[model samples]
Target chain A: MVILFPSKPSILACGAVAGPVERKSVFYSFFDSVIEDERWGQKTNEQGHSQMIQEACDILMKKAEINNLDVDFFLSGDLVNQMTPTNFAARELAISFIGLFSACATSISSVIIASLLTELGASELAIAGASSQHNAIERQFRYPIDYGAQKPATSQWTVTAAGYALVGKHNPEYPSIIAGTVGKVVDYGEVSPFHMGGAMAPAAYDTITSHLKKRHQKITDYDLIMTGDLGKIGLKILKAMFAQSGAKQEELDVLRDAGAEFYGDDKAFQAGASGAGCSASVFFSYIEQQLKIGRYKKVLLVATGALLSPMSFQQGETIPCTAHAIEITME
Target chain B: MDPQEYQQLEQQMTPPTPYLKNVLKAFFVGGIICTIGQAITYLYVIFFNFTEQTAGNATVATMVFIAMILTGLGLYRKLGQFAGAGSAVPVTGFGNAVISAAIEGRTEGFVLGVGSNMFKLAGSVILFGVASAFFVALIKLILVSVGVLEW
Candidate 1:
């Protein structure tokens, strides 16, 4: 369902941090920091995952010129079991925490909740976002990090990164959230976990089409309609779906995916980047910067997530996917 | 669209797997691993007074040890990705699986983590290997007992 924020809660500031391997990302310059070590000098990957989240929150607070006590809530999640990394970071930040789990869409989902809080005058300032670490997430979802398992071309590389955005009262100068859509779980009977994009494309299509229909807006009304982590093939499938619905070629041209173009045609990443952090880092950094620079006047950020646990996948269940979207306008 | 129709459309849109290319890569990489094993067997025969039959055990052990080292060094995973089943079908792949699981479980602690998880991936291989071997030997014994096969 689409929720209109009459108050138009603004994203006051954003902070994005990535691991060592993400230095090669096309939008690397947009990131606030890229640590030289994937572990971030932590003893374990989980510790490093927590460190990455803490670093992102710290940077967000620093950018907004606010301390942890000034923030009302800390909303975040990751792919780790029970989201321990985010939980640990929340403990350190000491902000009233509400951990969310919309899978990869947690970035936007958290922001949506924070925006709702801001609209209701319940929160003055809140930290909201998501994160993922490759080693930590991979070991849980698939195989051990050092295990020699052959992945299909449809498989996506889980990135190690964290992104947090500071949401507060609306400011005319910043990108303000006007409307948000909390997506429904859409399952098209896609069984292969390797082909996540195929499973999630229908959910994204459903959410975007319904969001536009509800808001009485056309696809061309926004400067961009970017999906979170639908890799190269997923993006193609999304486009095809739109085409089948009689969307014009030019209208479809505005569609883009953060994961598809993340590594800039590096075949090593296979289909493209995945994980919770993929959308979080790109949205809070690159897309936010683009809005600030007037490169995009209005945009729709739809973060899609495959909601399947390792146990569910092993039990021969199909992947149920969801996509959460927020319409942001720069005035 | 219905799920069945959507699945068909998705299948149409997705690229076909490069089976021929993958098979070629697997063949070459598997051959290279076997060639290395043969070289180790020859070395055992020439310098260690090991016959062809006796050298088999030593070569297998040596290959697994080398794979364990490569896995710890974080290089075997890359090779596995590049070569697909080529790097996996060999005994070295078994070594990589066990060692990798052990290394992965290090974060959880020693007893419950590394020790128990060391066999997480390879346990199936061992179970099936022993079971099949026992069944095959049982069939042979039955045949020999009935004079249907030579002992």
Candidate 2:
């Protein structure tokens, strides 16, 4: 389902910068939600996206000036209530229209919407962005803890920061999200919400495999086959599922679930994160790295967003996941 | 960035036991967490004469309260020493993190201290919570528009 953003908008130029918090705060510049405190420290009232939207606008404005956009559609949101921070930030930016979305895969969501609009000739350019904060995050999910708790090794801490990737015509500097296959949630009827990463892993594999199936290719075809935010369990489970579907073990490099890994076990379990921005932050960081190193060629950056609610959790219903794979190529 | 502190945290993260041991611990603890959740639900129904839905809310609240208490008493550490993800993955664990932050923040000052620092480890949790809700709403909007869902 295409949201409000345009298709394949030409990214005139893109830039990323972080505030003075810490090196890790750089992550907030990408994803909408991130806890300010590493699992080892104290907390804050700042929503993860709050910090991100601020910096994202600074970057977006500077980039917009350079890219020639006085006013444009602002499609942005985080895993926060009503997208309050994002909307507030959008108001400050004075954009034409704002579309809020909760696909934890905001990075890809932004890209997909922008790309589709750009390709459809709806608009020449647009911007997609997100950020996360662990402080606000921790408060929302669980009550406020003022001290240390016994956390397991699998637990991962959410990172903080916001990042924005500009969309315009294909340039060597900025990239475009090309031919993508939308993912559908297929409930084998066994996956659970608590085990969201695990549940979505198969859907990711299914989408990737289906994309490959259409092109008559396999996991071996791409330099890297990225899944949105399947953390340790999901990653492990996905590999097993892929193998079950006949994908070889040593096939491709997958960069996923990065934010929590940065914070480590002081805050998370299952060695991963649960939210929208998990994949967004990692993919943003990785995309920049890939572009810089020229290590990316035909990279399938598939972003995933979990579709679950309190109602679903209450009903003992499983999480329904959706993924969209956009091919980023060097050609 | 203190080397010793980093070392301590690093050590804390490393498992003292093998995966099998960890898995067994996680299974029991996780099962206990789930049972506690169910128990709370049951308690809500039996004592308060609540429905399954209201009881489920009680279960979540109970779990959060227990985790918060454990985080304060510093007793959850013992549980984590034994169980792994079992104690980590649930809402109880998220509760532990926020309460832990508030506890740590209390020593800092007051207004800007504990109150501001209350949600430390949970920033992303809230961020994504809101972001995901927006995404969910959008999806619901699209689904309803296309007749995929009635919401």
Candidate 3:
């Protein structure tokens, strides 16, 4: 469903923190901080995941010049089991917490909810975003990190990062969220857990197309439409689907994927970076910075997620995917 | 599009697995591992009072011990990635699998975690190995009774 925000909730500040490996990311400089240790000095990967989220939220609050007491709600999620990392973070932040799970799409989904709260005049300031830890998430969803299982080229590397945006009353000087689309679960019968992008591409296409049709806007209306983590092959599949639908070449040029281009053609990353933090970090830091500086006047941030658990995949169930999109425009 | 049509399209779009390259890697890596085992066997025969038959057990144990060290040091996984089935098909791979599972389950604690999960990946190998060994021994016994084979 497309939800129009007449109040135009503004992203007052954004904070993105990533792990040591993320220094190689193309948008590394845009991140607020890159922790040298993946575990952030924590005893376990999950604790480290929580630490990263806390650090990101701290940075966001610092940037916004607000304390935890000033914030009304904390909306967040992660790919870990029960989103325990985010839940732990919320406990530390001492904010009214609403834990969400749209898989990787939690980044945009959380923001959409924050915007709704802002529009309803129920929230003066809210922290919204998502996070993912490579070791923690990989161990949960795939194999143990030390397992020597050879992954296919379609596989994506989960990033250890957290991105949070402080959402508040509209300010013309900031990038304001004007609308959002809460995606329906779309399944194209994709079964391979290794090829997440292929499974999520169809859902992304569905959400974007529906958003455009319902909003009565053309593809060219936005400066960019970036999907969350449809890796190299998934982006190609999405483009192919669009091309077959008779989309013009120039119109398709605006399409981009945070996952496909994250590592800048590094073969070691295979299809590219993924995880809940993949889009969160990119959107809250790089994308938000671009909008604030007028580099991009309007853009659609579509975070797609493959909604399959380890049990579901093991039971021979196809991946059901979803994409949540928020349209950000600078005055 | 329908699921079948989309699946077909997805198949067309997805790249084919590089079988030739992977097979070549697997072959060389597997060969090197076997070469190392042979060297270890020779060392056992020369330095100790072990016969060739006795050295086989020592060599297997030594290989598994080395693999356990590599697994603890977090180096075997990288080798496994590079060598594919080469690292996995060997006895070293079995050791690595067991140790990795043990390490991964450490977060949950010792008895329930490490003890229960230590054999998660390698338990099948042991079960099938013993079962097949028993069946083969049974077949030989049957043939010997019929005077078709000698024990």
Candidate 4:
């Protein structure tokens, strides 16, 4: 018999990791960049940053009692080639599985897969998780900073962390995957491929509307409605864009996150955070943490991933992206 | 499976290494990858006589190509084991991801398969570079036009 539940069994053991960074630094700079069209050089990596993700994932998996084998499948990803950490680790552990997902929203996307698998009797136990290592993000996506490049304010800081939740029937109330809405590609030729994510808030706005349409719930009904780290600009644009959809950000005190903002001061940054892990760890850690605090009832997690193509860029394919939304009830 | 076997499997599945060791392993492996980066930096300077900025720009494209090949040979996951972030943190890392994804997609179509989807994300990175450079050029032009900032 298959059962479904929160990734955490005891409900006490949910985890998320966001590096320390303040929000204001990212917020102010993000707006400045968008308006001023500021130029942010790439962010380079410093020492001791890469391990932050590996450590976080290893710890959370251990806490959840998710053995590599017990996990029927290892559905995870990274901003690296072949999803190195997750892929290599899964290989070493010999956990044969499939990996499918949408960028920052991977965590939620996978959780949805795990839930349906568990619910549909395909598997009893499974691990649905995703990680983002800041080091790799910096090196791959932007400059490592050791190169001493100044960043424009709208740039997103990559967060180095991994968040995981074991999905199964551990608790009755904390249903791991309740319901979710899948996002569609929304592109306006005005947004550049590199700037595709700028319109990501619209993607989020689109998914949230889909979820609302599906569930028939008011925006205020959910205890929290968290979007994947749109960073500052993405979030603000997301909030503003929702106006067209009749969802007002001012009305909802829903927890907003740009996990990159956790990096705090001493770092020149913008927007908020912009990484797959930024949302993964932040959502996992925050939802789990707040579940304990007894503050939230329902949570909406909408994660956005940018889909861009080089051939498209050469041929000039405007960035075409898709997002997925997952709703979990800590009932 | 027997209880003993199940427990054994669990133990084996779990990272037998201590947390700190795993963390340090990631750090060192990542560091080794960065060392490659440093070497590349040196190459950029000595051979091309390019400024660090040009060198940095070139590094992204170069590393991405290397990552794509490594991903094809199925060596990246191993490197990822030794250096989690070190492997994933560079432009090459993302290249590896997109290329591998497209490679997997190849199972569906050979002619229009992975090759077609091959550069799913390369556009964004290239766009990021080009757009930022254009914006920077515009800013520099404005600055040059005024007397506040110099090129």
Candidate 5:
């Protein structure tokens, strides 16, 4: 079921921070802070993940003209195991914290939970954010930084970035979060590690169809229906799934994957960017820009995540996945 | 879906991997690595007065040591990216795999980090190697007893 916000919370401010690599991407203009140092001047890549979160949160607070004490809660997550980086960052920030894990779909997941909290009168102001580092994720999930192992063409490079959105009472100047749809874990018993797009496409399709059905809306109702980190292959699979379900070609045209959008024509990114930061960076930056400029009135940001562990993949278990969609409309 | 049905869906949904290109890269890189090993063996034989057989063993050891150093310096990942399976299927690749895990666990401190995690990736390779060797030796023993083979 789609959770409709009666008190529609406005995204007053957002902060998008990325590593030096993103500066090479087209979305460079959308970021508020781009640290050239991959380590963020930290001793390790794991430490850098926490530093990015803290910086992103600080930037969001500064943009919203609010202090740490003024915020009611901080909802954040990262791709790191146990989400220790987010936990450490919260320790430094000392705000009421809720650590979430939806793999790459975390940005929208956190936003949905935060917005729900605010709409239900549980929080006055809540911040939702996520961060991921290329090196840190590679080391933890696959091989170490030194393995020098070859990556398949379908392997998505993790985007080293963090994104934050501040949700509170509706404001005329900001885009309002009108609704959110929580996703179910859909696993078609896909076990391929390199083919994340295929593994996650089913869940994206499931969530998108459910959200549209619940709201009695057609695909044409939204200007853009974006999925988080489905990459190139995943997008094709999602479209095919929709087509088989009798969705028109024109209707499927609005579907765009955030990972594909950010790394367009960048051969170095193989498939695309995959991580919690993928949606966080793209939404808080590119999508937010289009909304602010009135280019798109209604947008469905569906963040997808492949809930797989290296141990599980090695143990012959299929990858389970989930996708969460948030409806943003500018009045 | 059942495993068989899911497998069919995966086959239909997944795109075809460029196997030819990967094979070419691996072949080229693997050849280069073997050529380097040969060169090291000759050097040991010619300059150190060692026999070819002993030099060959030393060459393997040297390559593994160098691979470990490259892993620590974070240069092996780049090689792996370019060479694909070529960098991974060799003895040196095994060294890189073990050292990489050890280094990754370094931040958590010695016992829990480096010591425990050093074999995360390479431990299986070692297990398989020993198991296969045992099987091969058992076969050799059976052949000798049956008078079908001579040592």
Candidate 6:
């Protein structure tokens, strides 16, 4: 079922922190802060990831003028084992924490959940965020950067970024979150780790189709329909799926992938950016900026994830992917 | 459709890896690695006035050390990606595996983190290496004792 928040919870403030590579992208201006170092002065990449999350949350709190005492809940996730980076970040913050894992799509998932809780009065103020570090994610999902492994054109570089948003009662000044669609893990029996976009495209399409159907709405109803980290291949796959399903050309035009938008013409990011921070950084920074500037009144942010592991890939299991959709609008 | 049919259909839809190209690449890379080892052994023998056997041992040690340093620098993974099994089949790959684990575990601390977790990957390699060595030694000993082989 599409979760309809009639009360329309507002994201009061949001902050994004990105690494040097991400800061070089076109979306850099939207972020609250940018760190030149991916290491963030931490000895280990994993610890650096936790540092990014904490810094992002602290930045959000500072931006929103909200403290740990004011935040009733903190929801977050990252593309790491046990979501350790986010969990560790939560520990540092000392807030009521709920760790989540939906791979790269985690930011949107956290935002949707936080919005739902805030709308239901579960918390007067809630913080939702997601983070991913290039080194940390590379070590876990693929190979180490030191390996100097050649990345295929299909492989998406994980964004070294983190983003956080504060959710509360709807205010005319802020973007109001209206609804969220929790996704189902859909496996089209794709097993290749290289073709993550291909593996995840089906799940994104499934979630988008379901959300549209449930709401009895067209894709064109929103000013922008964003998909999380589909990369070029996944975006192509999604477009093909839409065309096959007989979706109108206008409807397809509304789709804007975070992967493409964040790193347009940046060949450094092979296909595009992936990881939990991909969509999170894009939404909390670029998209939110547009919303505030009265450019996009309605936005559908669909975060996608390929729920697979190195072990699972090694064992020849198919990639089970998912995508969660959250509708944010301006009244 | 049944699960079997679904699997078949999915396989059909999925893109196949270019096995021929990959095999050719692997062969070239592996050959290059072996040639480098041979060169190192020759260099050691000529420069240090060591015998061929000692030079070979020195080459192996040098390669492992170089591999660990490259792994620490985060360059070995890229090599692994490009060369596939070519990089992995060599003794250097074993070194990379061990050092990578140690790097990952270093965050926990020297004893619990580095010491305990360093062997997580290489432990099996060492175990099988010793076991196989023992087995082969036993076989050689038995053959010699039976007068079928001479030491």
**Highest-scoring model, DockQ:** 1
DockQ of each: 0.81, 0.11, 0.71, 0.02, 0.57, 0.29
TM-scores of the candidates in the order shown: 0.98, 0.62, 0.97, 0.58, 0.95, 0.86
Q: Write the per-residue lDDT of candidate 1 for residues A222-299, one digit (tens) a residue.
A: 999999998988999999999998999999999999989888889989999999999999999999999999999999
How many residue pairs clash in each candidate at the backbone level? 0, 95, 0, 34, 3, 12
Model 5 regions lying over 4 Å from their true place: B1-13
TM accuracy, model 5: 0.95
Chain A TM-score of candidate 6 vs. true chain A: 0.98
Q: What TM-score does prediction 3 earn?
A: 0.97
Give the TM-score, chain B only, in order for the candidates: 0.95, 0.79, 0.93, 0.60, 0.86, 0.89
lDDT of 2 at A212: 75
Instruction: For model 5, state the Cα shift of residue A161 in Å.
Output: 1.0
User: Candidate 1 docking: what grade?
Assistant: high
**Candidate 3 lDDT by residue in tens digits, A1-331:** 9999999999999999999989889989999999999999998889999999999999998988889999999999999888999999999999999999999999999999999999999999999999999999988898778878778899999998889999999999999999999999999999999999999999999999999999999889999999999998899889888887889998889899999988888988989999999999999999999999999999999999999999999899999999999999999
* Per-residue error (Å), model 2, residue A257: 5.5
Best by TM-score: 1
Residue lDDT tens for model 4, A1-331? 1123434332323445444342333332221011111111222222223344344545656776665666565567766655655665565556556776577778777777766776666666666667665555554544322222323345576655556666665465554466766678765442343233464655676677777766777888887788777665566555555554465655445636544344454334444566676666666665666664667767887778766534456675555556777776665
Give each candidate's interface RMSD in Å. Answer: 1.0, 13.8, 1.2, 20.6, 2.6, 4.2
lDDT of each: 0.95, 0.59, 0.94, 0.58, 0.88, 0.85
Supply the DockQ value of model 2.
0.11
Q: Clashing residue pairs in candidate 1, if any?
A: none
* Candidate 6 whole-model C-alpha lDDT, 0 to 1: 0.85
How do the residues B40-134 of candidate 2 rate in per-residue lDDT, one tens digit apiece?
A: 88888888899988787778888889887787786775676567678877888778767776675664577776688767667779899999999
Clashing pairs in 3: none
